[model samples]
Target: MTNGPLTLMQQTSALRQAIRNQEHTGPTSGLATGAMQGNVVILPKEYADEFLMFCHLNPVPCPLIGVSAVGDYRMPMLGEDIDMRTDIPEYYVYRNGEEAERCYDISSLWQDDMVAFVLGCSFSFENALSQVGLTPRNIEEDVNVSMFESSIPTKPAGRFYGNTVVTMRPYTPKDAIRAIQVTTRFPKAHGAPLHFGDPSSIGINDLAIPDFGDPVSVKEGEVPVFWACGVTPQLAIKNAKLPICITHAPGKMLVTDLLDADLAVF
Candidate 1:
């Protein structure tokens, strides 16, 4: 790519190709602007039922969009020619509820009994926010969204249970209200802010220290807003202690061909 800006379609294609070729390995925020990005989870088919049930119990943080057939990498419902093993910019490999390694590609690690899931992401609504003059702070600062694990416990399903994870964006009081209105139109993208004022109310100790992704500035007049995040599943994955699990790195999502507007209710 060149220093000149690329159109949304062009950027989408470029990022897709770059990721496939292992040439780009960075946070995917603000790219492919209107595309519906998804949080990824790959696990053995045996664990699929429990994990799927967990998503049902926590719709706000785990709105599922697409799921691949056993051993299949293609997600036909979300996009064309998507390969689960190589599409995401980065992936976290976990073994027995412990961190394993981070890598750009996982082709060799893929298993025949594995199933892939695509969950709705907060990035999906960023375009709508930008169009309405309420661009997210992460987008404005060109960084991955700030994510933190909250004390709020999720409903249990089988063996899957964990605390909720949230993404943060800072906005002034008036703009925060407008953001709630705009985001409520896209339920798949986490609907609306869960909390907008004090970080401690949600068990977050500091805005500058995030559990995942980069921290953006919380200016003088702005207050940090929190939204249910797809990363909540990672916590469940850890708690479940499955033999193996694979997920997209926080802020690095699976960019689908679907348009964000298509997911909006109104």
Candidate 2:
């Protein structure tokens, strides 16, 4: 299949199809410009209940957008035809708290007891940021948002427990405040930020080396701004050490049909 110029939403749909057909398998960071994107998790039915509770307990970092019935692969609520097994650009297979393999799709690993989850992603806030002329540095640099595992502890539910992970974008204090106001409208997408300014305060030791995503320049007067990221679930999934787990690869989001406005709250 040929990659061509398409609108954000159209590109997302096409990319999803490409993923399903094994034509395109990479990060979806900037693919669907203004569309709502999501982080995904697939777990066994036995662990679904507790994981759901974990999400409820820590809604900011784990905003639950869609959930599938046990053994179901289709997420009708997210789009006309969103297959959890293949919609995301890439998948990370985990085994006993370890990353086993990264693949384009999960059809070969499907299980009858599996349940899928879709969580809000930071991409939802980009439109708002751009609207106000504070485009994120990650977007400007054309790279994935920088992510780090934070010291902030999450409320545990059963075996699902871990520190929250965050995504960073650098901006001057004045622009940082504007970013907070713009992101506040989409509570499902993390809503504002947990902390800004000092990286050491949040347990991040290095600004140049992120645990995930490429680093962008922090101008002389700019301070790094962070937001609760959907990747938090991946860390939690690792800590859970389930027999098997599946998640969207970092930057490889599940693009949905829902508009950003659909998730905005006043």
Candidate 3:
């Protein structure tokens, strides 16, 4: 490996180590270029089956990328070195479906019976946008993407049910069209824009403030384009009210070893 930060694999490993040590606790967007990133959800074995079905019924917002066996914290399918307890930069702990706390490391709370689920994140497609000269504003600003709770409903399964959550990116009409085509190739990365133009059309009354993540400035000639966000599963977890649930913070995704093209539908 080169002695600099240019190597993709080296950068990914270093980032993961930083996260594991609680040295880096921020969004994963625009880092580890070309590597697939994932939204995380950890639940006890008791709720694992229903959550699996939940993901199956609602693939758009919960595209299943990796799952660990009961009592296992390592997700070999996503990364051989992945430690579900500490790989993510930050974690949101939920009790009775409500966010109770945010923490850097969950090693103390990890249960032997816990099962971890990894879902594809929009960051995977953001790389594609950048490759095609349509870099997302969040990347340019070095901030987490703006995420909102939409009025759009998700397909429910058992007790898992909630509205879809979306991440926004602003672009002119011409760029938006090309962006849609570029992203459509990565279905696991939320595919295309769920809504563009009027944010209120999707129940988002203010683009200046977001339900989650840092908001970026929307240029005068640009329209806010929305894509299905992996954080949507967090909303479902809140509705299910399971005794306990764990999820990656809104924008702090788990950077995986898989390549971006591995997630492209094409």
1-266 in candidate 3: lDDT tens per residue?
A: 46664677878889999999989998777788799999899999998999999899888888899999998999999888999999999999999988999998898999999999999888888889999899999889988889899999998888889999999999999999999999999888888888899999899999989998889999889999999888888888999998889999877889899998987876
Ranking by lDDT: 3, 1, 2
For model 1 the local lDDT of residue 181 reads 91
Rank the models by TM-score, top first.
2, 3, 1
lDDT of 2 by residue, 186-257 (tens): 998999999999999989999899998888899999989989999898888888999999998887788898
Candidate 3 Cα RMSD after full superposition onto the native fold (Å): 1.8
RMSD of each: 2.6, 2.6, 1.8
Q: Which residue pairs collide, candidate 1?
A: none
What TM-score against the true fold does each predicted structure earn? 0.92, 0.94, 0.93
Better of 1 and 2 by lDDT: 1
lDDT of 2 at 159: 93
Candidate that would win on TM-score: 2
Deviating ranges (above 4 Å) for candidate 1? 1-11
lDDT value for candidate 1?
0.89
lDDT-wise, the better of 2 and 3 is 3
Clashes of each: 0, 0, 0
Relative to the unseen true structure, what is the C-alpha lDDT of residue 210 in candidate 2, on a scale of 0 to 100? 92
What lDDT does candidate 2 reach at residue 7? 66
For candidate 3, the lDDT comes to 0.90
